[model samples]
Target: MQPYCKLKSSTRSLSKLVACSALLLLLDLSRCFSHHTYEWQDSHTNERLVCKQCPPGTFVSQHCTRDSPTICKQCPKLHYTEYWNYLESCLYCNVFCNFLEEEAQPCNSTQNRACQCKPGYHAELDFCIEHSSCPPGSGVAQLGNPQQDTKCSQCPQGTFSSVSSMDPCRNHQNCSAQHLEVNVPGNRFHDTFCTACKISKGSEASDGLEDGSGSEDCQDAVIDFVPYEIRVPRRLRRLKRIVSRSSQSSKRDRKSLEELQMELHTYLVQLKNTEKKELLLMFITAGIVSQSEVAPFQISAGKESLQVRRK
Candidate 1:
């Protein structure tokens, strides 16, 4: 009985050891199954656990992990990443700008380099634009360079420019004259230059018409005789009477004053009568001469004739 009891005890111990060993084996299997496995895949495989994250500026379509079939995708061309740990995909870069000197800052979800425009280029919705030119005569030409201009110009001759940002002037077509009677050139308009007429050629009362040559008429010299003619009459006859009196007054001064006085009075009376007749004769002669000169053909004709009648 003792020996049988010993064998039974040994068998029970062995069975317990076997059961523990089986339990240990099952735990080991469970641990082996629970631990993560690394899976390196070609470009198209997908994985679940321990999947890699996509890189910056890149998007991942699938999750990839260890030891399973994984889809490991590279970033598109022109793309880069800062890190590589668990990176599911690489990012795509921005399009290249030929005219820009430097990269621009990133925008939106895309991780790209910013593009900077060169000098003299303005930024417009992802593009660089050139500046516009100002119009002539607007006074824009006087401005500094690199200015964005819409118009430019200069002032006319008659008019002056006040603003710097002005367009050039249109040709002045409406020039004006300074005075009347001056032949101002026609077709002067729109701020054309103004000119005065020649001093001698223009007058306040003269007509505005221009002759073949521009000149003025000179004034003629004048003489006056009618004012002096009527004041002194019979001057030559009076002088002739004085001369005759002087000639007749000979050497009888002291002897016979009464006789001398009588003779002088008589001579003076005769001189006055003679002077009156001479004045009548002067009027008659003037009348005759005037008539003859005015009517030379009206003189009556006469013929000298002698006739003897026989008895």
Candidate 2:
């Protein structure tokens, strides 16, 4: 019922009389209800009553009555209520993730379950497929994630992809830039194969050779157990001899192999043009280190790896 207010004083100002009635009307509203409530007509008394809404995770089991308040009940398992509601029953969980999909967020009293693709897979219409493997001569343009698939692209010129993998196109080994002779040029499928010891043309002329020809033979190189005739450079011969002599597994021996290999590698890297030893012995495959640099490993036998050729 509305509150009654009568400003009977003739001495009272017009603003004061309006304020008195407004205050009494606000008091009547406070006595009825506040936020998060609704008015309903009581079936027994035929009177309107304001009832509070049930909080999240619970629902109104019965409406407000003249003698009793609105009755609320807790949601059962696998059911949920998001906010203050007068719903009779909580919502049921109907969504389910598939085999290839993983639950990103578990279902709770307030939120629904969310799913996404697992690792190495990407989401499609309703399911997920495995990420694409970049084929030989092709490469991954973009890496795949939970929502997107791996993008593939063909290897461009001067680059190659030798394996079926997710990696991108690898820059081909630049033999000319490394000051080495290119025996087999690089394509999209394979990398440039460079000579093991000998340097290519155009290098010696830069070093004051009148008519530069990189083909210079060596009499000191030898044939070894490997298919290629491994040749030690003139600068590295001393270190190779020392490593060959060390038989005991001492601290000196531990450092000897590493030092010898490093010295040999440094000499080969620095040895350009005329300084580079040309393949003298007519071996089908010739290399100072190993023929296949892709699978290059240390030759443990220092003596056999660097034995001097006899006269």
Candidate 3:
């Protein structure tokens, strides 16, 4: 009986030791899981591990094992990881700005590079374009900024602009109402050109006509010289008197009269070749005719009659 009692006491002691070992193992597992650690099994070694998360701006190079801690590395230049991750490699941060654009902010481990349009350039959809300049006869309605294009508007009446630029149009010159005539009319791109009115001698004031007293004799001579339309002004009528009085003049005056006659002959030849009645009328109205001797002139065009008398 003493030998059987010793065997039973030894068996009870072995069972108690086994229960205590199991309880200690469960406590260790609960403590590990409660601390936010996760277990990962290795495929090659079949070993379990508790892995810690990688910090920001770094990536996990190797997972943790039961015997070793997790391995991590900082992200290289031009690479980034914005948050804690278990990725094996960092993301590339090599974004580039296009033409007409510039880098506003450089890339770093935590953020990407920012881009913006350059000066004198505006954003248009996905690209950039240069600002537009206002053209002649127009003004800049709105100036351009870095993010927007320029706006233009036409110049109003009494204003003019001659060149393309960002400046506003200028006001046109106003002609005097009394003595000046509008030689060239005002336009959006050019100012008005004015000329003084021609005053006549004696009692009658010929506003545009040249001074002449011997007009009837020249009228008869012109009728015999040309059959076609020749609207001669009063100044041209005086040329007949120059020819009639040339023989009575001195040697110097005769030489001057001859040169004048040659110039008139050349002009008449050009007028005949061109046969431009409107050009001849403009010469008559603008007082371009000379008071010198004219050669025999003949022009033939349609049935338009010649008016030698000045209005």
RMSD of each: 45.0, 17.9, 23.2
In candidate 3 the C-alpha lDDT for residue 245 amounts to 34
* Candidate numbers, best lDDT first, in rank order: 2, 3, 1
lDDT per model, in order?
Answer: 0.35, 0.56, 0.54
Per-candidate TM-scores read 0.22, 0.46, 0.36
Order candidates by TM-score, high to low.
Answer: 2, 3, 1
Worst 10 residues of 1 by lDDT: 218-227
Return the top candidate by lDDT: 2
lDDT of 1 at 235: 29
Model 3, which residues run further than 4 Å from truth?
Answer: 1-74, 81-88, 156-160, 170-311
Better of 2 and 3 by TM-score: 2
Best by TM-score: 2
Worst 10 residues of 2 by lDDT: 202-211
**Residue by residue across 163-247, what tens digits does model 2's lDDT show?**
6799999998977787765544566655655544332221111211112222232111221121122333332344344323433
Please state the error at residue 63 of candidate 1 in Å.
Answer: 3.4
Q: Global lDDT for candidate 2? A: 0.56
